[model samples]
Target chain A: MPIEQDYSKTENGTQPVESDNQDSNKTPTLPSFTANKSSQTVNTLWRTLITPNSPNVTPNSSYYELISFYVYHGLLVLLYFNIFIFGLITFSINRTKLWFFELAYNPSKSPSVISADISKLNKIPKRISVILNLKPEETENGGISGLISDSSEVCAWVVASGIKYLSIYEYGGELKNNIPELRRSVYKKLAVYYGTDNVPTFSIKVPHANAIYYGASDQDIDQQRYKNTSYKPILQIVLLSNVDGRATIVDLTKVMADLTTTNEISPKDITVKFIDDELKQLVGEEPDLLILFQPYLNLQSYPPWHIRLCEIYWEPDNDAVTYPVYLRALQKFSTCKVNVGK
Target chain B: MPDWMSTFPGYQQILENCTSLFASVVRTGPVPQHIGFIMDGNRRYARINQIEVKEGHNAGFESLARLLQVCYKCGVKSATIFAFSIENYKRNSFEVDWLMELAKMRFGQMIEKGDLCEKYGIKIRTLGDKSLLPRDVVECLEEAERTTANNSKAVLNVCFSYTSRHEITTTIVNILENVKKGLIEPGDITEDMITNNLYTGDQPPLDLLIRSSGVRRISDFLLWQCHQEHCDIEIIDTLWPEFGTMQMCLLLLKWSFNRTYGRKKYRGKKETKKEKEKST
Candidate 1:
């Protein structure tokens, strides 16, 4: 007597394998047919004529099923094509909108355009420092006036955009003597942009959103001197070279050596904190964003200790300082996630 | 004979001419005091080429030998290569063993040919944890270092089983020990002191850092020296085995341009006045 076969396994294996093989073979055929037929009517005819055999399918029902399958698949293809086209159209529209916005509001493109969106300015960094490369002959060939105009425009934008604090540093020692004239130029430009009534006054003592100029001799190396007053939201103009003329590190080293010789203090106790205390006396506070108006990332000896964590922004090929480029740099800085060596 | 000249007999004269030309061209710009290399993608290069892993490592070594010669010609005082990292020890045992064997063989070859180091005056110093390495490998490294101890024309730093964090931690521990011993007081520590105590204390701070295989991360190499300094980093898409002197020269040219034109305006007034007088 013949033993009963395991029909369940046979059915499960053979049915799926056969169906899968058929599906694998038929899928490519459909696409090839559609590609060769070219016209919609021929595709319908081809689908109807090439109805593959199914065990349970009758001629009449299979014909209707095949028609429905073609109809549904054609609808899906149309839907996907429409979606892709719509996506492209929307992307182009959004890009054009952004381009138009940039063209109209970019101060670099048209220096006279002072109008900028306050919402966009809300994202500006709270503390922004600009390091300008100032040459000795900056006064010649309209460079000084051009700088004054750029400074005024930048200051006006800062005020209008509601930025809290702005610091302008002349990287070389040449511009140190002309801080007063530069400050006056900036004040005049702000007045012209915001009208005399709204323009913030230039003050040396009061804690308000005002322009304060610091020449090399004026920068007192006493941290206690700035402790009492509130460092209010203000524009600070610093006419100092990138080089630390005071040689703070060298002096600190000397101080440490002297302390080690006399008091017998351990040298390892002179940590970054002790150095930071001296640095605080040198540069008041570390800037959140440092913008370099140069072609490359040569810090020009910006106080090394202070800029350890500062985010630096500089364009490689483009050296022309424009208000729009400055704004873009600020925008880029706002999006940066600073990893402070943690 | 130089290492490359022995390796490639037909191209000896061409290589010498190219070396001389590069030497002349490099003198026009400021040479980087120290250059660091993050060698990456040897295994990937092997995988792509369908070659034995050992062959890939040998190719990388060949490229490194050529690069060292170019760096010496360019007047680069010190060159550091991340030969094997602490993290690299986690790779498969087969690959790790192959790398270890390859390193031993290369160091042994260098030791055998004493004239190569003598000709170039290259002081080879391995920077890493010595205890983690095998006995023979460490012996080879020690031998190479001992033989090249006096050569000072150029320095080669092979970071084997090294990590920047480990280096920093080790330096700190040494400093603490000195403080405990009263050999150095805690209050005397400065940036320069810390630099002098580091593994690269005798060498200048890294001026240019080049990473191969298109990876942008520093991969924990030279953290202390590169962090606060103006060290320029160049990431190239080529694999370590494919990197050559031409790629290094291109990077050097860019860095030299940045140094010359980028910071020239910020020079002190005295220097500018002297230039003006010379022009007049």
Candidate 2:
């Protein structure tokens, strides 16, 4: 089978359908509506046939189960409502944490403060990836501009923490479309910290589009005090969205299958190491830590091939992209030991 | 505590009746057709209880048996458990040997006792590279499957020496081999094709993936299947040995509840904004 067929049958199988057919045959009163092609009549007829006006109640296991389920579901609904209330209360508090975190480490605060906070961690991931959600444009920190500013702020935090590689994944691929605006926003934000004279260089890459944009113009680099060598940026940022996650893998799989048919590659050659290396080349290498800014943890279809051993971090009831979350994720990655299945 | 509770008259029978009733009630609303579990923290549970590691794993097995009984009772179509990972072999040789021995002994017990598979009509399928397993373990696994070969009610996928990466790779390899054989064209290699050919091929789509020990990472168990929008990956803080059937039933109910009401914490997970709006 080339597809996952529905092998699942409920405890009640085709017996329900067979019984319904028998009911239609026996009931001469239902034939007029059954003969009618209108779905509206069929629905009412089906409903009447299924729900008898008088149910012969029996105080058996099935009867007791109904009462227990009522109580269970009633309690669950109440518990859910309670959780929603708590979520609302914590949502306001977490929103305040965003402001407090920014106030403690904003553009006005020198870059040294951020580095000091980062320096406390035992180890920080050289490569860190984050999943950012794009909220409705009506809400604050929610539209395209809000997304751009959030991206820049995270970029600033990543650079200040001295992390070299950063990947930002927006579920809808919104940031990929506004790269120029993102580059300008990040450059401005970083310049505020390091000052216009010596802003660190960074590059933004969209792996799906195979596009790269570097920060700092050639003339701006020419004015630097020390002649920068190696010609590499201090930070490398990769922009990924939903399409870049699994769609790319499917395309690669098709190509590989085609190549095999043409005798270009052997079937045995497509081993685990082969897939890993291919993914490393197609999609980027797996990041050591992934931070989700959502209130709860859901991958939202991040590239499955790359998340083999990477640690994922997310805050409960925290939705905004904040500096505190990023710093805390790094701190967690530092203290955590990735045994890599030892 | 467990021994004392079991010492009471009709304790086990009462517990079973309660679990079956709970499962039946949950089955009334919605039941996940396919479920996956990452049984973690066995070694940690062993150390915490000051027991031998072997006994911890044994307890974990007991918990699995109990949970799967509830799952099948709830009419869950297929239950996949991460019995062992390919990476598990990287552990010391002694542990690996013991784990194989434990599997062999437990599988022997399962078939002999006419346990869950026999009672619930569950087809036992060992999904992984059989070549890597010791000969005795492989034979025992085959025996279990052979005994349960004709079961049509449900399926139990025991991922003994498995990893998601390995499963995907093996699936791809098998696909390519078929293409080379001219059985199908390369164009047939769709995402569904790969998904259906994995160790979990032919089973229903995975609905719920539960990992114990609060380890957020999936540890490479069904990585491909769980990335889908519908799969709910629930991480519980309980150790594998201590995990209970009632906790699992409640988790299933929570998943159904969230799916029905579209809980915000669980939103943007299964449905995108536009799709949710369209559905409303």
Top-scoring candidate (lDDT): 2
Across residues B1-280, which tens digit of lDDT does each residue of candidate 1 receive? 3346557666878867766565545544467889999887777799999998889889998888888877877778899998888777777888889889999888877656644566679899999999999898999899989988888898999999887756755665566556556687656666677677778999988898887886444666776666443787676889999897777766776676556545444336546766998999
DockQ comparisons of all candidates to the true complex: 0.02, 0.41
TM-score of chain B of 1: 0.88
Best-fitting candidate, scored by DockQ? 2
For every candidate, C-alpha RMSD to the true structure in Å: 26.3, 6.6
Candidate 1 overall lDDT versus native: 0.63
Error of 1 at A143 (Å): 6.1
Place model 1 in a CAPRI quality band. incorrect
Q: Is the docking of candidate 2 incorrect, acceptable, medium or high quality?
A: acceptable
Instruction: Evaluate residue B227 in candidate 1 and report its C-alpha lDDT on the 0 to 100 scale.
Output: 45
Candidate 2 residues lying further than 4 Å off, grouped into runs, are A1-109, A216-230, B1-10, B265-280
Shift in Å, residue A288, candidate 2: 0.7
| Candidate 1 displacement at residue B274 in angstroms | 12
TM-score of each: 0.52, 0.84
Please write out the lDDT profile of model 2 over residues B96-182, one tens digit for every residue. 899999899888877765677788898889989889988888989999999989999999999999999898888888887888899
